[model samples]
Target: MNARLQPFVLTIAAALLLLGALTYSARAADPEPAEAPRPALTVTVVQPQRMAIPMRIAANGNIAPWQEASVGTEANGLRLAEVRVNVGDSVKRGQVLATFAPETVLAEQAQIKASVAEAEAALAEAAANAQRARDLQTTGALSAQQINQYLTAERTAQARLEAQRAMARAQQLRLGQTRVVAPDNGIISARSATVGAVLPAGQELFRLIRQGRLEWRAEVPATDLGRVKPGQAVEVIGASGSRLAGKVRMVGPTVDVQTRNGLVYVDLASSDEARAGMFARGEIEIGSSQATTLPQSAVNLRDGFHYALRVGPDNKVSQLKLKVGRRLGDRIEVLDGLPADARVVASGGGFLGDGDLVRVVQAANAASAPTPAPAQAAAPAGR
Candidate 1:
């Protein structure tokens, strides 16, 4: 190659290299710069307010029949003839629940009646004889020993009549017991007697729950024993989600040694919706308190510590270390690390991080969330 042509080729090569470098630089400058890290979320602050909050204990339990009865018979040699009551039937005192065959009873009763008649006849004959003996003694026709003998015979006959009367009464009682009767007003829960089935004396035939009254038996922790007392109001939740109100009727005298809990009996309010043995949860209002509270959603639990995001006056977000106190309904008390007038992010706090920029919005009323209605709310009647 010629020398001049070589220099010209090198210059051309250099120009091409410089152009390629410039094109790469322009391409890099065309793209947008990476966005800057956003600040923490801003949230409308809430001023912690003083309010009456209920102190309560939640415990699991079961519904129980207030009074349970196992029905039985006291008359032997009787066979079931008819059942007049069935399960779920309401009964009153003296109401006949069942009838038994009265054949043997009637036979015995008839025989006693015959014996009673015979004794009466014999008594009459002896009395007549005693009168005749006395008249003969007055006339000196009968000796004193003979008259005494006749008087003794008359007294024996009268005594025998009296004994027969007592036997008749016993037979009547046995006959009456052949029919099973309700001892008190109640609802029948079970029936075992069947027609033609022979049952011996003291045989259980039915079960009843007296007066349809029910109670919830809650097992509260021994440590919470101080929070429970008789006559305190409570709320009971059934397995079916039925809510019933009641008053504590009794506190057990002893605690269960194994569970370390005590039994609390709560008499159900006037609703008949509750049934025996249903799983139940009860809340007993132990006391009342006044403190700063926040919605449950506002709090976050991380590494066993409770925290909330608070918006500072500068609209910057900061994580607040919080100590929570007793929970009243859907809100928990903020024990510390929060000022009464600070705005804490409630709904969106869980999804935010420190220093993330967030547009702040006012939180709705905390009372709108799930919380116990105050006692003065005037509970609806009939449960």
Candidate 2:
């Protein structure tokens, strides 16, 4: 009985072992399962646009008086008796600014007046003598030569009297010259005259800014000088961040050879913030023109160049180089290098490279994504 059962068990055990081996060999022969493909990046896109933009030229310059009026003394070798105005004082035309010592002029005028009085007496006597000579000539009561001599003496006295009167008038003019008056309405920028200080004729006493007006002398590049025209509006920015409005008055006739720049004179509207000798930056509006533009977010800067991620029909992104111009607000002008109808990534372009697979997402859907709630705190165990 043991021999027969042992043979049957041995056969069953051998068949079980063979089945296990075959199962193991089949599992080892099968290939591994493939990995899943990565999901495409989702992004928002926008189209190029066209709009009008202002053309302007930026320049820097100093503010100065529109015209400087130099006031000088007319009375030579006279001591300045009084100065009525100082630096930064406003004066009107015909206003007295200074006065020279009038003592010497007054004394000379008195001497001339005495001489004039003496001449009047001499002319009266000459008139009587001339009448007598005329009477004698008709009667021939005296020789013709004697009568002629009397007439000639009378004429000489008359001439001397006339000369004395002219001297008196000149002396009067000298007295009037002692007072210095403002030539124009203006603000005094400098003063050199002082009380009791002797000054010669034609010596400057004060420098006035005519009409208190100022101008901005913008130094523009010679190449851009032609773009600046008279009557164009300009905005000047001061160092204190104040803005002053001005108009282009004129452009210099010649360009400076050393700096390659030209002067564009701009008349500044009167403002308290604007003053002479101030350095300011200005922008002059040349005109306006149409330009192709895009949102600033759509452009990306890479490797020191500007690029935009252009999407293809298959929703794939390609980096496109662009030439950019003036930028205003959130929009930038595309001067060239982009098609009008091309779609570009609205934002997050910096994260993308050329030829990247992307998923086009509606802007409304992306903006509507629910914000994640803050994590809740753990509760006490005993609660």
Candidate 3:
């Protein structure tokens, strides 16, 4: 009875061992290959474009009059009368500006007139005497010596009368100098002479600015002087960012030793808001050309080298090395490497590596409006 039970137990043990072996074999089937690592970023990209761009250099400066002058009296006398002009008044050339005391000049003029009259009478007398002396000498009615003496006396009298006439003419000229007249059309900037004030010769009585024309003198650093030139168009922005157009009239030939800068003069006319002596900021169009330009956001600098990711026809990304030109505003010029129609990653470009597989979506195809800069990990430095 014991031997038969032993056989049954052995069969059960074998069945259990076979079931365990089958379960282990099913679990040993090959596992699936590992998936590729995904890119850690999403980005927005734009195509490079060719457009007209104005290259400008910026500076700050002050406004001043182009032609400023101080007009003073030439004659020495008390101010007897002032004309209708005052400070800030516009005056025309040759307009009477002021008058010295007329009484003194009038008295001198009268004396000159009387002297002229006396001299004319003496000339008449001398002429008559000379004629008589000539007749006497020819007819022998008088001694030759006597006639000669009379002629000499008449010549002396004529000389005296001529001297008197010259003195009278000088007096008249001096009287004309008493009235001050404007030398040019200008606006009066100052007035120091009153109606009753006495001014000496060469005393400044007025200051004027001619024709209301003004200039902006911008102090440009010596390093930036190359960007300024005569006849270049410039724009001036005020403290409030108001803009006005002007042309450069002059560029100083020499740099100032103290400030290490040069002056650039921009001529300006009166505008509804522009005023002289106001602080202004100027931007000059130093140079310009048509070029392919892209926003700075589209460029990525790695390892001190510039690069851009170009999108292919199939919306795949490839690395593009670029040569860059001068920076203009928010955009940078693509001097090399990028074709005119190549699309570049505008934002989040730093996240991409060379030859990386990307599932790109059109920047405009996002269901949600393109969000402003979202937080992303820092980009790796390129080699």
Candidate 4:
């Protein structure tokens, strides 16, 4: 090989080596890429507000008639001839609800009437004889013993007449009682009288709700008895989900011995949906009060305790256990364990844990957002 060619080959090799060194330097200057930080959840914030919450005593009760009447048979040993009104029939006062076989009663009454008539005839004759005897005694035409005997006979006859008249009146009363009538305006709730059943005196034939009115008998705890009073407003919800507005009519005088509960009687407004013997729940409006409350969705239920997720300024979430009270609509009363000015997650708190970082979005209700507190000046060092 020629020495000149060797020198040219070395120069080309040096240029290639320079290019490789420049490429290595550029690769070393570039920085490594970092991983992207993700948020656990994107949420909104809320602040508690002061609102009016109803103070109520919740109670379980039964729906019953305001007053009940038991219509019974007053005629003894009489067969029910006809039933004019059945269960669910409305009746007025003195309305005939049923009729018994009045034939026997009528016969007795007629016999008593005949006896009364005979007694009246006998009394008239005795009065005439007494008057003659008195006149004769005054004139000395009759002996004293004869006069005394005539007076005794007249007196006995008059007394017998009075007794017969009294028996006749009683029979008439029995005859009228054969027709079972309503004592008051009401709705028949029950009827046990059959068409041909022979009923005795005082046997109940029908049960009636007086005046077609109903009541709610609320069983309240003994502790809350003092809070109940007459004329308080009550909202009762029946088992069929029907609501009835009622006013407290009375409070029971005594509490039950076994349950330590008292009964509160509430007279309900006129409603067709309410009936006797229905189970119901009631909320007595004891009063109202100002309370700090939050939306129910913002609170989470865990292990029978309520919790809320509080958002920090650094976009971190802190779980706060809350003591809650009555829930109205979609809001709930916060009794304790939460600050009135706390900025908490609006919803979805169940998915978060303590110390979880979250990305807070703009609040929907800006007016409810808590204002930022004023910044304080730094204190002088070592003052």
Best by lDDT: 4
Q: Return whichever of 1 and 3 wins on lDDT.
A: 1
> What lDDT is reached at residue 157 by model 4?
87
Residue 115 of model 2 has an lDDT of 93
lDDT of 2: 0.84
The sequence of per-residue lDDT tens digits that candidate 2 reaches over residues 17-37 is 999999999999986899955
Give the candidate number with the greatest TM-score. 1
Compared with the true structure, what per-residue lDDT tens digits does model 3 show for residues 1-383?
69969999999999999999998888777566799677545566687766555666677899888898888877776564765589989899988888887778778779877877887787788778878989877788988888887788788878878888888787777777788888889888788877888777898878888887778888899998887789988878776677777899989899999999899999875764676778998777776568676777778888877889987665568889888875655566788899877767777777777666566557663222222221111111220
Estimate the overall C-alpha local distance difference test score of candidate 3. 0.76
Model 4 — TM-score against the truth? Answer: 0.74
Sort by TM-score, top down from the best: 1, 4, 2, 3
Give per-candidate clash totals: 9, 0, 1, 0
On lDDT, the stronger of 3 and 4 is 4
Indicate the residue-level lDDT of 325 in model 3. Answer: 72
Higher-lDDT candidate of 1 and 4: 4
> Higher lDDT: candidate 1 or 2?
2
Cα TM-score per model: 0.78, 0.73, 0.66, 0.74
How accurate locally is residue 57 in candidate 1, as Cα lDDT from 0 to 100? 77
The C-alpha lDDT values of all candidates are 0.82, 0.84, 0.76, 0.85
